[model samples]
Target: MKFQTFKVCGLVFAFLIGSAFLGSSGSALASQKVPISFNDYHGYTGTVKYIKSVAKAYPNITKLIEIGKSNMGRPIYVLVISNMKTGTTIDTFVKLRNKRKEGVKNVPPMKPYQGKPGHWICGSTHGNEYTGTEVCLYTIDKLVSGYGSDKEVTRLVDGQTFYVCPVVNPDGLYNSIEKGISQRQNSMKKDDDGDGKVNEDGYDDLNGDGHITWFRYKDPKGRYVIDDVDPRLMVRLRRNAKTDKQLYSVIREDRDNDGDGERGEDSERGIDLNRNFPEGWWKTDGMAGGRGNYPTSAPEIHAIAEFFTNNTNILMAQNYHTSGGFTYRPMGTAPPNQLHPKDVAIFDMIMGKKYLEIIGEEVPEAWKAPGSLARFKEELEKKSKNKYAIARGYELPRGWRASYNEARDRRYGYGMASDWMYMQFGAYAITTELWNPQKDIKDFPQFTGPDARIEAQRALLKYQDEKYGGKLFIPWKKFEHPELGEGEIGGWIPKYRSNALPGEPLLNVCEKHWQFELFRAGLQPEIVITDAKARVLYTANKANSAVVSQKGDLVSIKKGKSKGKYKIVEVTAVIENKGKLATHVARGAQLAGNREDIVWLIGDRDKITHLQGTKFQKLGVIEGTQKIPGYTGRPGAGPAEQRRMQRMPRFIPPGYPMFFRMRGARLEPTQVKQTGPKREVRWLIAVEGNTPLKVVVTSQKGGTKVKNLLIQ
Candidate 1:
């Protein structure tokens, strides 16, 4: 059938009625339900139409950005949603909020705390996994439609920005739609069947039923026997318990279409997008499911990698997939015992509680499979210290099995998605199987009696045939098989089975799953500056009759009266990591320099004094000095002459130490300097005192002056 827009008129009417009760505010009034159903979303044109509808519906809040183009030249669009009033842009919010507190006053300041970190939700990384794309579309609709109406929605939108990429593998998705069967690889064709030829043959509809159903051939000695209780159910005889050798019944199909003895073994396959990430990239066959020889080998995967690399603000990730009824976390490949102790503890605390509340079960405490997206997220956290979570591998609900006794016992337990997330990224990632076809039935008990399970399968087939029409099962049809002569190609059709249910009920399930995903997104790590402080330390060294200043010559004594010269050299401050994590240094904080000025000098007729120290030591002089004959005099030099004098170092005795004092502060010299014009001047200094004595030293040049000197 051609791609047609299937409007759910009845569903939309019901939604409008229900929305009236839910919509107390006018914001919800503007939301109009589009006439699009998930069943028709198998085509690129349909997907684009839905995306455009969302964009046009919420133009003020939703913006569609073309991050890149797909191999087919289709625009890969990213939908960004944020509150305009708060001025909270995606990258801007993350960058500004991570700034240092001391530098908050400069230029543009951050907005007041909004109470949550920004969030990102991506979908359809796997081409065959189309459920996430539909879910993302629904989520966008919910967020925009409820912006001013729903309290929780408003809080989420205002508190954090949401970035959504609906389809990461559009090429694969489009191909699946056109081919009438979902293929896991991207659009690039390859020799997947391995017949030593490329894209030569693949599965064909031998029954001409417009669907690919399992084929069964009659064989008297078949290993598979019809259950005594239910003819619809087939059971394999155990190898050891078999009475005689029997034929094996594999999925019934002929390999080659043309009249040939050889089976069709070659068909096209594309790159596996999950294996194309940069974090745990492996060559083809080097890692589990690694498709290509290098990362970004596929155009679609390359586009996604480029998008994420540029948008570093994506803190949380959830990848949706088919039926398994469980929430999964991270550390995909590492043994559960090998997980980081602290990280494991945190993971248990968060996901453990969430799973119990949401799914009524806890994730099995074990390690998961390798080379999955969950492992990729863990590697990302290790590399950037940013948190990422993966919610994948959801199983179909058991409802599908309720109708058939044979299918009932096949229900599997929750698989990997949620656990992989918690173990790896420390964020809660959930994989929820959206729909359970086996609804309203108690968990199916294992059949112990003869033919009980087969009987159940017969009943299920009868119910499916009666209620959902013959869509669930293919009527047996005769076809001239290439090898089997005359054979019937018929069994279970795709959507009618439990795994692939109709779009209406599945969409509802997706809506609920999307809510949980939204909750997980809201909880991503939000790093903020809780507190900051600074401390200063002063060090000085003094020797007999001479002083070495560690912080320049802020202390000096001349003629026993204390100081004729003193200057504040450098204030040494060290920023400590008092918080739990390392704090980044602000861009401009005046870290290495003196904050004030004080000049150092010695007074005498010909008595020369020296100052020695290294430059850029955070203790260097102010690089300028003036000399005068007397303590009280006007300055005689300008900045030009001062600069010339600064080039020359004043070297004191070899062992002389340095002393330091702040400008306008008292100066107490521990050591004294003895120098005069050949005993022409005799000076006696007082040694004992409770407080340092202040002495103002003035230059004979009449312009230079120094204060804050004391004698101890």
Candidate 2:
């Protein structure tokens, strides 16, 4: 033991939300946890402006950053929330959760938890999946209002950073919101089919309704038929000689727009922003824009790719999608066996089961009005009399079991952003497919058939009767078509029955997602400087002791025969990993393109070596969660990972305490194991009165920790 040092070790709070602190808690100047409802869900532009308003209202902890512009020149916004302090002070001390005797088994007490990681969240990757925009606004609202007031919120703001990009595809998201038609991609100029043409024709709200829903009509020989159990539900008509029910083919509400021999197949801006990431990008030819000509082809995606690449401390990320109501984890293209063996356990049981329970609890069940079923039957009969043709869309998500990977859903999606983040940067990525109507239906419904969309259709019908007085169901109306001749166009309003929730009770559902997201962020590795101190070594008096030759600037000696003393001090600190997961994920460590952060001792420049293992990167502060530099200013070269070391091999187990010395006089170092957490150990060095021995530790997810001590 040297000079007495007081260490304020934060008792790593495992709970993310609804947590109470027993400390010197402070209140935020202007903070309130006000709930923003979906009375009229904020569309893309509205959501963007709302985020800005939140940042303005909470200028101390929030900043509205424009990352880049969409293809259609829509500004991409990322709301950054933090304590807004740039410099470190004595009060900005390291709270190494348990830097003292309570050091966990694996990691050591030599390194302190450095900085809080940035938690990345975004929604509306698929423009038509409108719920994401709302979720983003809701998240912004949470961070803005909860900054210093809410205990959990204060912790996240002061400790960790939050990045919320509400609408990744702003143009398309707003188009879907305003026009009831979302091209599902940015309004870019690209000939999707390479048809020597560009975005000529596709999709039309022919009925003058605000949605491009199903264009259903009777066909003697069609590929789909109305389900016998639920007349409102459409099912695939499998081949069978005995079954003579008429089949129908439902097309998009359009005719042959481009005259490309395909009906409403190609549209302008056919890029799938989600499928334009830099990881595992391959031309699937399975779906349009499934694989852009090159990775990060979309400007929005490019901005996001570079934004994350420039930031290495992001701990976890969630990409919100819709309708499936399932939590999807990585190895997007790889099957369970193809990925790290441990990933299955992480994805299936931990991720799936936990979120399943949470979502099940958050969203309520659908209420069918009494006698609505009889009206539904009458409506079904009237539609049946019309003998309208039935058609099916097979590619939709159907079976939603706890671990329903979309029923053999293993294509790794050519350029899915989720997979890109996980595979390229080792970021813990999750695709949260929101809102499965069946999940809200009575009996806790399960997708028994190949596709459970029909059950969702049934639930929607019931919801319409109960919520909207059966108005959601549009009666089949005749429409003369140039290509398909006389036909009818009528069906459910895609936006009405889709993931969009109408009332406030479902507001809880939106809030519950935040619960899950915050929970995941709590897993960020935190290395706390549990204890730190410095001791004075023997002071050599120049007048009495023999003058020793100095080996460099380790210790400077005064003139001989002089009444002077040379003092040397030793410094040490206790460090512990408070996060549940390892500092860096296994996959992230093995990827060359990912960051391999290390701990370093900052002493006299002459005493330290800039060798490969003992290198130094001056990450002065954990300003990771703030606005990304060069976001809007820089012209993105391409995907950020392209500039990374994608083939490098490096990995360190959680809590690995490495050793280093800023040498002055050669001395034996403390003995310890090759790697893994270590108990307090002494450093051999020379120092003048009160020398500042600073130690900086860094983990990809834990941000950075810089602590200094004075020794005399």
RMSD of each: 21.5, 15.2
Per-residue lDDT over 283-332 for candidate 2, one digit per residue giving the tens place of the 0 to 100 score: 45544445566888788888898778656667688888876666667656
Q: lDDT for each of the candidates? A: 0.44, 0.60
Full-model lDDT, candidate 1:
0.44
Candidate 1 residues 59-108, lDDT tens each?
65666767666656667777777564543222221233455354533223
Model 1 RMSD vs true structure: 21.5
Q: Estimate each model's TM-score.
A: 0.55, 0.71
Model 2 TM? 0.71
What TM-score does candidate 1 reach? Answer: 0.55
Candidate 1: residue 139 lDDT (0-100): 79
lDDT of 2: 0.60
